[model samples]
Target chain A: MPDAGSRTASIGLEGGRAVTARPTAGAPRSVRATAARIAGDWLPAVPLLILAVLLLVLPTAVVVLQSFRGETGGITLANWAETLSRKSDRRAIATSLELGALVGTISLLIGAPLAWAISRALPAARTAWLSLLNVGANFGGIGLAFAYTAVLGTYGMVTLALQRLGLPFTPPPSTSFTGLAMAYFYTNIPLFILLTLPAMHTVRDDWMEAAEVCSATRFQFWRHVGIPILTPFLLAGWVLIFTWTVGIYGLAYALAGSAPAAPVRLMTLQIGIALNQSANGQQRAAVMAAILLIIATVSLVTYRIILRRATRWFS
Target chain B: MVFVGRLGRGALFAALAIYLLLPLSAVLLSSFATTWTANPLPDGYTLASWGEALANPRLQAAVARTFGLAAAVLVLDILLVVPAVYWQRVRNPRIRVVTELCAAIPFVLPFIVIAFGILKLTGFAIPSLLGTPPLLLLGHAAIAFPFLYWSVDGAMAAANVVKLNEAAQMCGATPLQTLRHIIVPNIGPGLATGGMLVFATSFGEFALVQVLVGARFENVSLYSLDLLTRTSADFGTLAVLTVLTFIVLFVISTGVVWSNRGKRGTAVAGARAMTAEKDA
Candidate 1:
């Protein structure tokens, strides 16, 4: 990774040395050349910089700032204190972490094998599966909640069919935590498959064959070679899923209404019912939002670190 | 061992098929089911729910609004993302990592948190812009930027945009003329793919619309959620809306894939040529 200045200078030397080397008769051409060089360096970065500052950085700053504001407008930690002290707020945080971990684990359990299979499948089959997974990965939010209800709700098609078949237990209503987890599985499993398939493909046949030549059994080869190589990718995938589930609000909200998930509780407290009723509702919402942001940032940083490690292995 | 391997593969395929299709089929069935009380199959099927959903004035309004917002977001995405990506790739490749991290912030952070933050920031920063469509548009554009930028960047890289620009300039084409005649045409597939992705995402986006302007604006997803939450909620109608959304997203994604397929050979050829030129 050469710096932009060096790369541009090299290209300029190769392509425009004659023009650059010529002695300028006046200051205007030199000034123009200097101006062109500056524009060439900085102009492209301006739009992305502006977008980052205005959209991402400023809003995040506002959340962090507002989380510290007290009722009377003075800067204080009272909002964070009051918000965190509540039993329900603590419960929301605990529940969210639990759900994220559970979703990450379960989806990976299913997704890894699926990614492995897809990676080993014939090319046409692989393409078909990948395309389906791509479409399915985006099947989330309110629409997904509705789909799950149609499958798992009290009068759901699957639920009713299971009852007709004399199954011992009924599927839980879509409003339950169990039901929300089930709905999330639909999105998470496909997402994991999509995310991990490329990594799975990176485990070349030649490596396994080399292991076999070394008198390693299939299971031994996988344990010694495959799993070690895939560990970083797997860990990164899980972290991504964890962060995704932690920040997810729509699927849980649509499924459970105001009932089940911590994300819903935070939202209700922030913008929904609590905002109108409580005087310091906005501050509390900011606090909760800040907490969610911190969780996401930590998970993302972990994911990036894992990805960097994974790149070292693959590269 | 061979028999076991075949069985394992077959089972994997079967499980994936069921896992992916079962929920979707249930929704599709319920949309047409006259009664699906206690059987594996629907008692009978009808298009009444589809007709009802289509006829509903609110659904119509929502469809119009969703498309309008999606279109606005797509335009914004193109205007901002194309230049930014072009700049990063051609002029300042060193900033690539930073641009990527910034673009990825939306994907990492939940839409709810982003919406909430924007809502709070706008209240004090641009009081007049709060709760307006433009505010929502800005949020959607930010959310959609990463997809657009990556797609366009890939195309620009494959096309070897710097060499193309140099060639056009040597041929006496002005910068603007070179961009219009050479670069845009070459990256048509990337532009279309990015536009379609932005449109699909914006059309189906729920959290931003629900959080920022839920009181005033009703998009398809928000409206569907409203229908789903009511005590006397019509499952059939909800199913219809879900199917409609799926159909729209499916078509747009298919278009993207189809365009990519058509251009794959050329993109590969161009990439090889670029590498060859670099080697020379």
Candidate 2:
């Protein structure tokens, strides 16, 4: 919580009054004051700010600028045109969105119930389980992709077990667009669980008890009370997952190799591969535009919706 | 009566346990299977494959490089994140928004954007990122920043930071002294948790290292990837590494979470005791 006095002090100091008030014309008061302020705040960020801007900001600006230009220094929409011209490119974008949506939905389905169970479970076990869930959720991408490949690969034990049970196990064709989506969903379960856990905790037990005392059916309670309160949070979590998967290149690259792995392939994997080719600069630019456009739309829409709902908390 | 509840709970735990453990078990089994090339199940169990992997210098180098990068990023994340978050807590809405926008840049933007941005700016003018420890650290830090920032911010939000700072200030402590003596000690658990997450991320990261750092410096994940792709697969080494990583991450996460819970418990107890004292 903001301290009342600190708030007052910070507020009072605004417009140069709080910081440097001519220092009574004393020797080194201005310098000491400035040094004190800098030491208090800016010192910690100096190295990080320098590194982040150099390592992150500069390259991003260059890519965006380069994407809008031709090799001959002409600005053109030709790259955008080229990216859209290909059926494969369109399909790639479609697959990525589909994967993100499916993963978000399924993970939510699995995660929400699990989160509820954990919240109600014994405290120590709950803590232990949540920690495990955290690790699992964060453990995916490249490392987990390979682990899945080993488990579900052509000679994977799951397939072996299914075969022994007289069930036809076709090894689930690991190289297709569909397979990649399935892998993403499988790995994403823990992530959704972890993200949604915080929201579940925020729903205090007393609120649930109140609903239960009123004889609210599980579905009715969830619908009328839980859903309204938790909807913004769920949406926020979903959007976060979607944004993450949209930019995910590791799983796409590792699992599907060089194949056009659908929508994700177009935006991330294909972009990387396209960049490697000398003649596909325009195509790469077009793909980048499309990817950025998708990200901007999703993020902006989610931000607006969440921001509106978020104001209720402030009020 | 408790028997039924215990049994029911046990069954529930078993199901969840199986779901989580099965994949890991499968991987570990394959890691030791000698004839993975010939049979669906490992034809023979042996440590030979693991020995070979460990013997290779590349794997060792990569593991070293990965840890080194993780350490660097931990420092960087704290340095950038603390001030930015503190200012976010202190500044006007507009300044807060701008700083938050800066902090959130990595989350919204993909890795390629970040990587490409870095590369284009520093292309050959400075040394290449290829095999450079700092460059690898930067890539990992970019990915790890959002996690560190969010977790630390959550902890800061929960703590009564301004009150503590003001109390210290009233006690005649300088700003630096207050932050060092009061703030840092209280927020220790958060910093530790964030650091652990950053460590785990960099240690396990495969993509950035492979793309930017390459095989020149191999972390365990990259090494595992290479082993998987080898014509003669080495499951034993992969097994050992997986088990070790799982154990290390489990310990770090549990430790951080436990410490945070302990601090929270103390805070609650202290508050309650103070209330009681006032009543008396």
Candidate 3:
């Protein structure tokens, strides 16, 4: 093929005695070659580098800086101190963390089996399920809050049905912490399925068959091999979802109006009801945003580590 | 044992179906219902709510603006990411790690936090740009960048873009021509899928839009939030609007899945590129 011919020719030219065709050291041609090499290496990366600095790095720096600045314009730890000391702020942080953990765990438990089933199903069924999951995964934010309300709110369809059936139980209102967690789970379970589906395909059927030939029972094979291989992916998914839930504001804000979560609290303090009600509300919100940034950074680092481990199996 | 296994599988399918369809059916039914309060089924069915939703000028504007903004974001992301990814793949492989980390930043951080940072930064750094559609566009592009980059990167790898580039250049094709004829057509599926996914995501995005531009701009998600928040909020109308949003998303996703149907093998190969990305 023409492709193979060029590749071989280039390799041969590099490998063979071609020193005489090259420019001498310290000559203008060598200088030009060096310049060309440097341009080739870094020029294409410039646009991305600029975008990263402007969009990601600089804003992050601004948050960090604002978190330390007080009303008087000098640097101070007062914002951090007040954020930590305030009972309401501390509770919001705790609630956010607890919600993230709860949602992450629930989604993983529900999604793993579905991912396994989808992977092992017929091709047509797999495609259908995968597409459905993709839709659900993307179906989040305000629309999700509305759907949940229609299903489980005070006058919701299911809630009313249960009321008529004399079940003596009503689901929580769509604004409570528990309700918010349920809504988060609705979207994220599908997200977990989508994220893990690709990873699950890496589990080879031959590996399972080989274990069977070695007298390993299905349970034993799964316990020793399947679970081990799936652990990193599950952990990565958990962390990703956890971070996702932590940063969420629209659903909680839309459903609950004002919930005791870090994101909602930050919004309230920044520009909502809490804004300008206090002298330092803006600074406090900045501090809280910075704290959330820290939590996100930690989650990302853990995700990267788990992804590294997961990629080993993938490769 | 086989019977038990079949029973388990059957139960799993039942759960999956219920989980996927229940909320959707609720939304669909409520949209057409005249009144659905405190009843197992709606008391009456009507298209009045759908008409009311469609008749509202704000809702109409919201739909138009949502598509416009999403389209702009998609174009900007493709333009910015394709070259960076192409260059990284073809010229400087060493910078892959830095670019990947940059792309992953938005995925790791919450949109709320990113919005907060952008809001504060723009307030001081570029006050003129604040509360504009362009700012929101920038935010959407940043958030959607990773998806676009990864999809195109995977497709590029699957297409053996490096070899194709080399061959094209040896045949005296310029870089621009190579990109136009070789790279774009080969990675058409990835570009389409990425574009559609970004469009769907931006259409549904709320936090950034709510924080960055608020009511100055109205997207579908924000419009839905507005309806729900009003004291005299109409559930039927909200339901209709929700269904409309779902239909648009459903259509786009169907296109993506349909385009992906016969190309399953290449899709797997594309996914492997992401795995290789992590290894770097």
lDDT of 1 at A89: 73
Of the two candidates 1 and 2, the one with more favorable lDDT, higher being better, is: 1
lDDT of 2 by residue, A1-315 (tens): 112123334443442332353445556656777687556545555555666666666656666666666757788776666667776677777776777777777777666667667656787897767665655654455556656766777667777667767878776555676677667765577666665555555556787789999998767777887777666656666776677677777667666654443333546666656543334554364447446645855675574466346324422
lDDT of 1 at B168: 85
**Deviation (Å) of B276 in candidate 3:** 8.9
Residue B268 lDDT in candidate 2: 13
Candidate 2 Cα outliers beyond 4 Å, as residue runs: A1-44, A258-266, A275-286, A293-297, A300-304, A307-315, B1-13, B36-41, B83-95, B124-131, B151-182, B230-232, B262-280
Report the C-alpha lDDT of model 2 over B1-280, residue by residue, as the tens digit: 0112556766766776666666667667765777664345777888775777668676667667666777888887887777665544443223343343455566667775565555555554475545576777777786677667655655665565666766777899876687678776777767777778778767766556655656667777767666655768555676666665666666766665665564322111101111111111
lDDT of 3 by residue, A184-283 (tens): 8888888777767766766679998999899999888888998888888778778878888887777777777544443334332243333213444777
Query: Per-candidate interface C-alpha RMSD?
Result: 6.4, 8.4, 6.7
- CA lDDT, candidate 2, residue B198: 78
Name the candidate that leads on lDDT. 3
lDDT of 1 by residue, B88-198 (tens): 555555556677677667867888777777877888888898778888998888887877776787678678787887788789987568777988899987898778888
DockQ of each: 0.40, 0.28, 0.43
List the lowest-lDDT window of 10 residues for candidate 3 chain A. Answer: A1-10
